[model samples]
Target: MDSLEQLNQRLREGVRCDGDYPPVPGEGNPNSPVVLIGHSPSGTDAQTGRPYSGPAGELLDELLAEAGVKREELYITNLVKCWTWREENGLRVNRTPSAKEIKEWVPAWLKPELELIRPKAIVCMGGPTAQHFLGKDFKITLQGGQWLELPEDSPYLKLTGHRLDPKPFVMGVVQPNYLTHLQEHAPETYPAARANLVADLLKIKRVLEGKLPKPKAPKQEELDIPF
Candidate 1:
């Protein structure tokens, strides 16, 4: 899209899975050097007409602040633009988006959005979101902290419309949503999970300060003709 407003407008004008709610577009500085992507929006996001709302959002703000990252300067979006929620126990809860939904929203909505933002860093907040760009086998526990270059041939480029040289640094992190999940279902692990998320964000902070460099892109090999 030519403008962030156009991008948001496209979503609002046509894109709809749950038409009952307004689409939540990526917000913050459209040209931000950093972008934080979540899997999907929560019910609160629908209500607020923004991404990252409710309890998870509160913790996300605290974590970003602790990590010296300002949400105001970073663009934030989701893998899916809409809130993928279903009624359960008389309350709404986020649900796993179907393959069709992922195909419809992610490649089309998130791709051009990233192109417009042209972020230097892309932080995929959850495992599924990470794997969508990274390989399906990516494991956050092992690779979450590492800053890897998005290869020129990366499907991410085609999927997310990232074409700049020395493509954006990609890092996976335990989502704040997961932290809330830990708090509710696995209380003992919440502290460590929270700590790790902060540590990852701190890396991003250092990257922005020119103190830490992301891994360089791989060089292409030359062909030799012995004839």
Candidate 2:
């Protein structure tokens, strides 16, 4: 089977949830620079078999648009291919999948999805997806907003960072959900997070276009929002 077909088969068998993956792998622009990774399919997303639905997705789409990356120009996926939820007092509440679960499912399908897309950079949306895509050692507080090498033995089952003709760099960022939270609860941190995200996207763009100068990460002050 071709890579996409193989990826779907793994998703069906590996992820222990009812959510369906996108009917087919999204046809991202071959020129896309970043792969946006999330943790799992939300309830609506699972039923629809699409990544990012409802308000969260709309916010993410807006963020991407602000960064000059169109939806069609980027690839998106989740650490777990299906939605994992539990019934709580008659309501289904989402829970973060366990580390063991992420380890089990991501390698089988998500990694293959990355291999097929072969994006220039991987932008993990939150700590969980970041950790899943990079390795157990991945840390958001320590490593967020910087480019780093994907660890050896990553679940990118068929995708090997060591084997890349030109290795792709991985980046971590605050998830849109957290961004929304910060906007509501701790407005102080919102500007910085948003700035960091845009800066990272610009850096990714420059690197992909061959204009970047050996990855000189900008300092926090340099990322100050232009007003």
Candidate 3:
């Protein structure tokens, strides 16, 4: 089995991938009870060589503290390991990763990382991260904050060879960057957005401590909202 250090080395080396920016591996304790998965790194991540190190990261830190969780105690990573971007008007603008990129990278890189960490609960921050583990039709706006259980036979686990000893709890939330955007452009919605994210983080703490019931699969009717 590859160790976390080995995985980080692979990511830093940019082995087996092609992208303008070098891969940014997840950071924090490998055995952390909770794992945070984001969409992808931003240009700031490329410069700082850290996941969630930009404005989004700053807000995330504040939210983590509000939830009484230390940044060092949780494993943090991204769905796409690198900073995806495009040159526009002489500036590098971050872009959402294409589905093809996610499809290719998850199995080869993210899956193995999950297998190694084997977190008891996964907090997927943003649409891509949620959809990758949940389902393509997952809409964070409608289902955010609802806990969903990942069973032993879940394709995610089966693909990563994760053990069923501790069934993982998964929850979705809006991306921190999106929340920041709201704070800037849609000021009216910022408070509600931040509150929802804080609530989700607190729920994660409760789930980790067994203070709450394991999340059940959502009913089909519950998930019928337009994406």
Q: By lDDT, who's the top model here? A: 3
Candidate 3 accuracy as TM-score:
0.86
Worst-scoring 10-residue span by lDDT in model 3: 218-227
Ten-residue region with minimum lDDT total, candidate 1: 218-227
Q: How close is candidate 1 to the true structure, as a TM-score?
A: 0.86
Instruction: Summarize candidate 3's per-residue lDDT along 1-227 as a digit string, tens digits.
Output: 77988988977986533455667889998878788998778888887889999888998999988987788888999878878888999987888788777776778888888778877888888766777677766677667788887644454554556564466778878877777787788999989878878888888677556565458565432443121
**Residue 189 lDDT in model 1?**
85
Deviation in Å, model 3, residue 227 alpha carbon: 12
State TM-scores per candidate: 0.86, 0.75, 0.86
Model 2 pairs whose backbones collide: none
Backbone clash numbers for all candidates listed? 0, 0, 0
- Model 2 lDDT-worst window of ten: 218-227
What does each candidate score in C-alpha RMSD? Answer: 7.8, 5.6, 3.0
Per-candidate Cα lDDT values, in order, are 0.76, 0.64, 0.76
Alpha-carbon deviation at 51 in model 3, angstroms: 0.4
lDDT of 2 by residue, 119-192 (tens): 66777877776666566565666667788775566555334333643467777777777777888989999998
